[model samples]
Target: MRTRVWDKMIHLPVKYFDEVKTGEMSSRLANDTTQVKNLIANSIPQAFTSILLLVGSIVFML
Candidate 1:
């Protein structure tokens, strides 16, 4: 979640800030949250059902 990412951003060491800029962090936070949401909502369930469907179809055919 973005909240968790924001909490992590808040806890970063000062040395980390020396190399990475605020804009880059912001963009990454946005991207990370999007990836997480997609994985949870779409990717995992789709994979699970696709495997079940494939097995069911093969079993029914046999």
Candidate 2:
């Protein structure tokens, strides 16, 4: 699901985009990819770890 969404975003037609005309495509590509990287690099692992910890604690408590 995420991969499909990201593939669509990455393959978006840049030839006629307003941002491309305005010469902002570089920034858009760089910043958008960076934001996505931050989520995948940081948030996903943290979320997975937190969920695992919570489940482990609950099971231990029981």
Candidate 3:
């Protein structure tokens, strides 16, 4: 998704580029990807690990 956004920005017309600043595009791409990376790297794996541990403990206790 971030790459797609970058490709779109890269192919945009000169008028669009003139109006938009480089820092804004760079920040947008960086932040959006960072947010996605944090979620995938942190939240998703944590949730899966918690679920696995809970299930394993329950089965072992039974």
| lDDT: worst 10-residue window of model 3 | 1-10
Off by over 4 Å in 3: 8-26
Identify the runs in model 1 with alpha carbons over 4 angstroms from their true place: none
Better of 1 and 3 by TM-score: 1
Candidate 2 global TM-score:
0.63
Please give each candidate's TM-score.
Answer: 0.84, 0.63, 0.58
What are the per-model C-alpha RMSD values against the true structure?
1.2, 4.9, 3.4
Question: Whole-model lDDT for model 3 versus the true structure?
Answer: 0.90
Give the number of the best model, judged by lDDT.
1
- Write model 1 residue lDDT over 1-62, tens digit each, in one string: 89988899889999898899888988889987899899999999999999999999999999
| Top-scoring candidate (TM-score) | 1
Candidate 1 RMSD computed on C-alpha atoms after optimal superposition onto the true structure: 1.2
Clashes of each: 0, 0, 0
List residue ranges in candidate 2 displaced over 4 A: 1-15, 18-23
Error of 2 at 25 (Å): 2.1
- Candidate 2 structure quality by residue, lDDT tens digits, 1-62: 34555566677777546445444655555676788889999999999999999999999999
